[model samples]
Target chain A: MVPPDERSRALVSVLGTAETKVTFEDPRSIPEMVLAVVEAALEDAALGWHDIDAVVTASVDLFDGLTASSIAVTEVVGAVMKPETRIAADGLAAAVHAVHQIMAGAYRRILVVAHGKASMAPYWDLTAWAMDPIFLQPLGVNFLTFAGLQAAMLARHDPHAVSRWATTAALRRSAATGGIAGPISVDRVMASPVVASPLRAGMCAPVGDGACAVILGDPNIGDRNLGEEDVRIAGIGHDVGPHHLMIGELTDWAGLRRASQRAYTLAGVTKPTFAIVEPSCLFPHEEELFVEAVGIGTTAPHSPGGGLFAGTAPVISGLSRLLRVVRALKGRTGERGLAHGTWGPAGQGQVVVVAETP
Target chain B: MILESTIRLPFSYAAGTVGSRFLIALREDQKILGARCTSCSTVTAPPRPFCSSCSRTVTELVEVGPDGTLEAWTNQPGNGVFGLILLDGADTPIVHRILGTINPGTVNAEAINMTPGARVTAMFAKDRTGRITDIEGFIVEQDDP
Candidate 1:
């Protein structure tokens, strides 16, 4: 028995990939936005419809206002007649699931994709559904509320937390937007009105529509046609914590701690100091939470310049982090990088991935 | 232009399964119940017959708290009202409407503030319906009235 904790597996590399082409328009339609991502992934990977073996997509059916929304997305990703699986969490969750397939000797290669657009429906509405229906629904709670509660908790203790979050948001947004969305200044973030106590509009992640795609395959049959530069995935782990935010200790993300410990063991990471970390931080405060939970402290440069506060593509946000790690590692900027994704209120579900340069 | 039509999805609760029976019980007596996993001894609200963790059928009935703490709260921007709530007894949280106006300043005040850890109590409608909405929603308590 591998023993659940010490289960080490061989590494797999992420093949050529592409990010969604930004179309600066409000209320972006799902079909229109998703097709662009599919087309871009196909073009970037230099692969046609015939190259893909199976497709794995991540999406929440309720968010799309359609049940089994993955069915509609398959055609765009070229998954017609291919085995498909839908993950109800972040894009990174689907990517991790794909890695499992490859590790289990099930499929040789797979296409992992995820998409989310806050334009089609209210993002808050979608987040609210994740709450307890009988008790929390009537109260009308959403993710932002949790952010507010966390902010309130921080504000009661730390004097500089809110200001620091504002600074982080401004810095990230500036780096992510280059003739993309209009530049937002630190002054703008400071001046933005508070949506929830202690959390301002600028501190929160901007809702945007986008899609992400990643191709994975065994290294033995490494095809030169699919980009020579490869970033290998060394370790991956995920955990779900207590759903009730109030009952569990909010300050500590124990779920993240356990997940990172598992991932580091799998990746043989004795020391994570030199690692470049890419984390899915919807809000600046969340960035702090993720960093603290992973035990990286302030030692590692996170998101390089910015994160989801830069602009989030919903379910695709986590995979966006993975892509960021891939780009950074391929550039020789970092030897090993940590990418983390969190779902539900106060980080209910957590996933961690460690990517290293081969 | 692509043409689309509005699809109405109307479904009913058969209450045949044990999970449905519990829902029926909640509607009949405003009793909140949960299914306890035989293997792990974890009680799940929105009860599940099969333990998600152990993959074993949960046959034990564990009546959790009729009241739960308000873990989180929010108001729909427009149209209808909704919130995410975790009940006292069950492991899973349920979403329902708040009985009265949302108060932002004080916990569960008439205003629109959804502070975490706000104390809330469930309110059932006079008419009985074997659906999740039968509870109408939960209300944040100001004090013993």
Candidate 2:
């Protein structure tokens, strides 16, 4: 546990995973998936539900096809009769909000949870609703089309962008071990059937259902329940770009750059460098944008565990990346890492987190 | 047992003053309207009530274009071609369906005459409903000999 004097604010730790298919025969319900992750998080933190003072959850009402989707997980998250806030975007954004609560001295320990089940509804079809109803939606411009437009623009900007993206997709998939979808070669990626023009089937992250839970607390509480190793959430930042695609630059993730700058400033990172970086890159081209926006060298260790290409749940992808970094830095000393998450068309919303082994 | 049920959610969206006027223009005059931000001088098609850049409430509605240039485009499998068109007078491009046949599936440089910088003009539907779809789609403007 953290000492009383150092009880200002910190993400005590995190835990979770993503699966393309939860079960072979029967698919797990939303609450069931959320419960499993919550229980595992408590186990990892060695804390009980009673110890959690507040809860922050990430879920989209349209994705669940139910209003107040957070209510579905309230009982499982132990948020009944307690303060619970829901973030309708990526899970990492929810985690960032929970950090604010701890820092404000509103809660001693906060539980952050996120879940997404793509099997319930047609994922891309639901994404269309997120578009401007009057203008873009009527034209049938969904997430895939927006991605196609961006990829096409990138290709147009750089003649070799298509081949480069194919290489990146192949590398990421090949690095994935025990993923639901197996690896592919550059040739195979380039030859794969086109879903959206330049974006091949192999270049897109396989969508799936998943749930993640992370527990954050003051340093004093963390130090009390001392474990073999400890990782602290040093800083967190998130930004929302223009909702309309016409308003912002399609190729550059300016929002991510702003978010990362805020996070780096808070973490006292003068030079942006990390031992490992896990980016929620849903598309191969997005990984390229992420690297450029975050100011990380091309050779920097990125998504060693294959990232979203391996198979990522929609809202849960970002939080899962955080979980990966936390777990990776747990035993190591003097190691720092970064995890990035994005939402909306062409990554309009971005969240970044900086962490270190203490 | 697999239980199946269809959920239909009924919603009523208030288009507000700006949207209502824009729709009226499209339906009555077959004219495209855009909202001009006085602060930033940026015009957005399918006119909105507010400007995104300068955070100013825009009340001036301007007639933009019957013709526009295609900035980017894609072919949606079953759906016909669609492209982002920067209408003649608007600062931003509006995404709309492209009528006429060139290619059917996949977004390629050669498909549906969908290269960047292509010229197109609005083709209004015969039956107007004061909705965005009333302007059925955009047709590629042919070059004169």
Candidate 1 structure lDDT: 0.70
Per-model TM-score versus the true fold: 0.76, 0.92
| CA deviation > 4 Å runs, candidate 1 | A1-10, A23-39, A42-50, A65-67, A106-108, A127-164, A179-198, A225-229, A241-246, A249-251, A344-346, B1-7, B13-145
**lDDT of every predicted structure (CA atoms):** 0.70, 0.79
Model 1 TM-score, all chains together: 0.76
Per-residue lDDT, model 2, residue A65, is 76
What DockQ does each listed candidate score?
A: 0.16, 0.51
Q: What TM-score, to 2 decimals, does candidate 2 have?
A: 0.92
**Each candidate's fnat:** 0.10, 0.43
Q: What RMSD does model 1 have?
A: 5.7
